[model samples]
Target chain A: MREQFDIPEGVIYLDGNSLGAPPKHVAERVQEVVKHQWGNRLIRSWSEGWWEAPQRIGDRIGRLIGAAPGQVVVGDSTSVNVYKALMGAVKGTERTEIVCDESTFPTDGYIAQSVGELTGLKVRAARPSSLDLTEDTAVVLLNHVDYRTGALHDMKALTEQAHDVGTQVVWDLCHSAGVYPTQLDEIGVDYAVGCTYKFLNGGPGSPAFIYVPKHKQATFENPLSGWNGHRAPFAMEASYEPDPGIARARVGTPDILSMLALDAALDVWDGVDMKAHWARGMTLTSLFRSYIEQMTSLEVITPNTLPRGHQISVRCENPAGVMAELIARGVIGDHRPPDILRFGIAPLYIGEQEVKRAAEILAEIVN
Target chain B: MREQFDIPEGVIYLDGNSLGAPPKHVAERVQEVVKHQWGNRLIRSWSEGWWEAPQRIGDRIGRLIGAAPGQVVVGDSTSVNVYKALMGAVKGTERTEIVCDESTFPTDGYIAQSVGELTGLKVRAARPSSLDLTEDTAVVLLNHVDYRTGALHDMKALTEQAHDVGTQVVWDLCHSAGVYPTQLDEIGVDYAVGCTYKFLNGGPGSPAFIYVPKHKQATFENPLSGWNGHRAPFAMEASYEPDPGIARARVGTPDILSMLALDAALDVWDGVDMKAHWARGMTLTSLFRSYIEQMTSLEVITPNTLPRGHQISVRCENPAGVMAELIARGVIGDHRPPDILRFGIAPLYIGEQEVKRAAEILAEIVN
Candidate 1:
């Protein structure tokens, strides 16, 4: 599996959580899609393959996330999908408050705020564990994996608590999906949105996927109701009639080129053992944390015993300077502003050896 | 310029208005972007070039559309951009109606309807000539070129009229942008949204561009205010504070792959004369209309005396069958149901010879 991605030589890339290294097969697949499917077939390719790409690729992503068929459709950016999911979850509800956390990704929080502003709902920010869900709570937006600290929230427990208070839950799985398995359907999550550019190893800014359980699909009203979501998009009707099921989640023309790149990148997970993959990620992160603790004066911010995702974060005095030095030494990680140095341990292409090399370099730079 | 495209041999592609043929440079550019920039550079590529692609490519597109340097930024699908532009235009206005026409693209009307539904405004659909704009009209969404008829609207006259009634105007430049010269700033348009895939020869479903005038940029409030539009996106702020200029029009991480393809596609227009391009387009479309009128019994629905864009539509019996036969004979055009065969003449790659060949095939198939 390590051979599947095109990680550059002499560079220990630990920034897979920001932008996953492109898969080795993506170049050839994109070439075929660009030259043969698009250049040769021209407009006819829309019907032949392009039209169904969102749903088709969505199904593959759904399989990885433990979602049922027809419940996931891939399109738009994660931020846009976050808006749609939040809107769909809150519509038709008398509840007027959207419950979110301060630690969620900036875009997710901004989208929640925008949704609140648009719909006249109150956006309530609370700690993840202390979300005081009440009858006024329309939607609970939570991230499965913390983008800064790699803290993993218990989705099932949080969703149950939200449901106890009659609040729908929408999960932002940007740092979690494809890093590990998610039982969204089993957990009864009302809506979920995730990006492919990170742990999924889709090319940069590839389209994101949204999950809407089967029961919610028929009545889910995406606010960005574009013609592609129509029951018969080719009919050219002036009126907006959303297609039934997850297809209605689609808002515009599918980015065929990037979508195909993601489709090719997803081939790496065809028969992947996701549970084993998650375990390997844990092992690598734990080893990196131990090495850093033993060798450097930096403090690990990610909780050691808590359920976490594939990344680890450490606190340093000057993260920007340290990160610049690490990159100069061919160890590529990122610094989330202020003082956090984050390293992502992607199990597919990244292994224990890469993790050890990265830790060694970080220790040298920090000391 | 015809030699700059990778049109399939033996096919007279007359559907550039539907989906422009892929540029010869696109495949190579996409490969380099995928394998080198994304695969090797990974997260660093965002800082290297990916972060500015939307605005950079948008400035290139702005040059062709007669917009100022900082007035345009590209991201999102055309439908999504339509929603953003309409939302930005209608916000804070006391006017209650969104004026549009039946000839607008279905997605445009649907987006207008969605906007009306979201904002509690009435969507008034009427003929372009009888828009009936009053002080009550908040925003008027008009297509510069009729999608079905190829009739070009007088942007200057209509925009001035809308302004006279105190209505903001949003132009859908899908059919006009790359096909001819558009003086968006000179016309005093408030907002403009257009797709790059059609005449611009961007790959299928390439991200769309939105233009907001320099003066209007400060007050334009796109409802889908994601974090990318933030003043400091990397700051991880919880509140939504939009960035100052046209950069605020960007909603999310750009589709870098498609953006790069569009960037390469736009290179075909570099240093080329837009006036000359429009003249060649007019000449080719004129020849096509004359050839079809002379050789076939089909009625040319596209007006000859009226100003037109790149495409010409003809009304004929059994258009679906005729189009299928024509396609089999290597004359590639599209049929809009209830009997219209649409032919697009893109002067960038299409010429008078291809137009004549398509007309001959249409005559053979129809007769």
Candidate 2:
């Protein structure tokens, strides 16, 4: 159905993992918000709809991610949301260890280090293979999928292990949100944060979302409580009394222009089946792996038989150069440091032929 | 002249202090970015223009605030920046006190409480008359201008006293930046945070500015250390090493759309002297004060002295009702609790005629 949408010609977009390509209707949405809501409605839009974008959109994202209504609020960058989630997760807990993987994204590690350094708590972030879950762990912070390696974490098992030790777990869902199925509610994860750009296709710099399970929503303390999160924002209270809903996580007035893009972008996901999305991912990734392995002496860092997210990572001896070559050949993907080339498969706007051709292009380039 | 710029008509645009009216050029700027920088350039925009917005516009804002060029960086909302500044201020210090005012905006107090409740530090906040500026204080956060009452703090004395006690001072410039003149450098204030939407007239949710003086630049730590803050954001370093200058304060890629509005809005300030801005503020506040005093038995909450910020606050019997009435009558301002009406005066755009007519409208309704 998204064939009706327009993506630029000759551009093979694989960098959705970094910043999603613009949604079809984002331009119209931006124009409307700038001309009407801001130009005409002015400040009254706060009362009209300007104020509730965070909660309204949060609930919409919650529907996709297995969260109930009123348990997710969108605002800030994903990293900031990570900071707030970790800070709130650690609050009032006697546990001293904030467990995470050392291979985590720098922001997550930085957040863990920041929380630990400022709070004097110990952040014991080891490789998952070497991790020891203990009662002293306050929380576990992990990406649902590794950004560079594209390795998936078993949410249910890790969450259960953390919970069995009386430790809370906060999940970063940046790469897993739209292309894969998640059982956040079923897994009983404590908190989650993610950006919309990767798979959700919220355009660049779109606001990020935070999920606090209904059980944790009422108790979460958003460390960055700007006036927007006030119980009665217009009441102008001096003390911070959070709104009882997921809206409590909002830190400031959202960028409505960027925000409306997310809403418009989500419209594309209305009828698509997610399994079909994952199948497309696996098919493309498998083609990519098999083709590159046969065509050239390339090392695929993405695991062969492990559960994976919607991306493939291969190690070329000159990944950056090969990536530039791939881009020149009209196949767009990104290269991480140390010879890792990453490609994300998103089916909403991606077609099977594109994947086949992309693999063929990789094969030719490698040869 | 700013008068050449057109604001939409017939709306008594009072909430410039909440979310500033858009600069006339912002729509076109947004159009340019949406169609060109993003739709066309796509990811290349990051390496070209998008990545530099945080420090680039920060320096623009620093020019207005009398900060040196390398001392300010823009990113995060005021609250997140508050957490970063406050957290960074207290690390490795012997001081145990984090001082604030109870009447400070919840974001300010909330962050101080966060530092204490998250970290093991002790927090000391005071009401107006009882605040303690003591030796044990690691940092003192005071609103340069009170959000509710339009009250101003004595930056020189406070910063000097804090320095005398080996403590740092963090100024929340939300109510002060682009309103009138305040010599933060002249006052030796160690660090400051200010939003863009208020008097600076960036659009809603503009990235806030953080000022770390040139002297303190070497020791500053960005507690919110996302990839953007790393010394080589593109290098993708394994360990975090912050950029040497104000770039150390950047945490995330800024919203370029919002950053552009602030960039253009600073044009509203060029060549217009701040001395004239301050003098006009006094005149406007005095006129509005006289008008409010002439008719109503309402109390004036803003201090009537040389040191206060440029806004005027008049107490009403029922603030919400009065604010509604004022809005209906087209006199734009904000109402704070129990019963306080506050108006911010930006002399570059607001003049004696606007203030006098605004007072007459208030007098006609309140009487």
Candidate 3:
């Protein structure tokens, strides 16, 4: 699996949680899309395959996230999709409040705040475990895994709690989609949005995905209803009637060049099993954490009681300076503001040896 | 400029109105970005220019649209940007209506309807000329050029009219941005959104641009407020505070691959004057229209009383069949539903000979 990525020589990249490294063949495939499909075939390429790439590639992502075929469609940034999902959740309901995880990725919190303002719902912040769900709660936005702490939240339990209160759940899967086996279908998550550029290795800022299950498809009102989502997009109709399927999640013209790049990138996951892949990720993180605890005085901030995510974060003094020193020595990790250093263990391309070496380098810098 | 694009060997690509021909150098530039920048550098590429790409590429596009630097920021689909611009316009106003052009490109109309629904503003459709200007109108959404017909609207006059009624105006420049010299700064247009993939030749489904002039920047309230628009995006602040300038329009992580391709495509417009470029488009359309009128019984639907846009639309029976037959002969124009056949004369890659050849072929097929 490590042979599948174009990892730079002598560089121990532990930032897959921030931006995954590129797959070895994505560059060649993207070039072919640029030269042959876009350059030569031009507009005819849209009908040829480009028009359906969103749903097609979305199914590829769906396989990993436990969404059945036609349940996911990819396009737009996660922020835009967050807005759509939150807005779509409260459509005909009389609920007047949106409950959001207090510690969420800023974009999700900000987008949820905006949705609350637009729909006249008050947004309240609370821990996922203690959401204080009520019948008046229109929707709850939760991050499957905390971005800063790498603590995995129990999606199934939280969703059931919200459902018990007759409220929908919108999960921000940015940190968990490819890292963890998020069974969106089994959990019956109302809506989910995730970025491909992180654990999926779909280049920088590749478009995000929106999971709109079959049950929610008919009633899903996409607020940013672009022509592409219309029943007959080519008909150029004035009235907006959404497609009666997963494609209602689509908003506007897809970013094709990036989308095709992502389609190619997904080929790397073809024969990989999510459960086994995530198990290997745990092994690698466990090994790395053991070395860090033994060699450094820094405190691991990633909660041990909770199921861990793909990354491990450690609290240390002058963490940005420590990360800069570590990167200078070829150990690539990112630092959150103030005092936390984060390292991600990507099961596909990253292996035991690389994670061990990264921990050793980090221990040297912190000491 | 024709040589700068990889126009297919035997196709008269008149569908630049729908999707522009890919620039030849864009393939190589994107390949390098995928290979060297993303593959080798990985997350390091964010600081190595990826982070600032939306605003940087936006400033280059601003040069063509008569906006200075620090005004236009590019990302998201035109549908998403329409929501931002419209919602940004009616922030502190007490107006209760949003006036949209009845014949707008469907995405603009659909997005306007959604925005009106969310903001509690009633959406009313009217011709740009006959819009009932009133103090109650919050914002007027107008297309600089009609998508179905190639009629250009008067921005200066309509903007002045909307201003007199204390209503802000949002212009949709999908059909006119790169072909006509849209003086957004000079006209003091309240807000505007445009597609990059059309006359800009920014590849298929390239991200769209949003223009928020200096004055509007202070008062513009981006409803889809993602953290990327935050004053300190990297700070990961919980409360949303928009950046003081055009960056406030940015909502989320940019689509870097498509955006870089657009940045490379904009190089084709380096020394070309928009005024002279639009003059040539008019000349080409005139020559094509004259040939079609002389040889075929098609009714040119683009009004002669109004200023023409880059394309020429002709109404004929079974227009889709006629367009298919025309495409079969390698003349690639598109049909808009029941009647209209649209041909776009992109001055950069299209010229006198290709336009003439396309017209002669269309005449033969129609007759």
Candidate 3 on B230-334: residue-level lDDT in tens?
Answer: 999999988888899889999989989999999999998999999998988888888888888888888998876536798999998898898889899998888
> Of 1 and 2, which scores higher on lDDT?
1
Considering only N, C-alpha and C atoms within 3 Å, which residue pairs clash in candidate 2?
none
Ranking by DockQ: 3, 1, 2
Q: What clash count goes with each model?
A: 0, 0, 0
| Per-residue lDDT of candidate 1, residues A256-365 (tens digit) | 99999999999998998888889889999999999999988789999997579999999998889989999999989899967899999888888888888888888787
Model 3: pairs clashing at backbone N, Cα or C within 3 Å:
none
Scored by TM-score, the top model is 1
Question: What docking grade does candidate 1 earn?
Answer: high
Alpha-carbon error at A216 in model 1, in Å? 0.2
Error in Å for residue A35 of model 1? 1.0
Question: Model 1: per-residue lDDT, tens digit, B33-127?
Answer: 99889987888898998998888899999999999899999889989999998988888778889998778899999999989988899999988
Question: Which scores better on TM-score, 2 or 3?
Answer: 3
Q: In candidate 3, how many Å is residue A187 off?
A: 1.4
Question: TM-score for every candidate vs. truth?
Answer: 0.99, 0.93, 0.98
Task: Give lDDT: candidate 2, residue A51.
Answer: 77
lDDT over C-alpha atoms for residue B260 of model 2: 65
- The interface RMSD value for candidate 3 stands at 0.8
Q: Rate the local accuracy (lDDT) of all candidates.
A: 0.90, 0.77, 0.90
Estimate the Cα RMSD of every predicted model relative to the unseen true structure: 0.9, 2.6, 1.2
Return the lDDT, model 3, position B308.
75
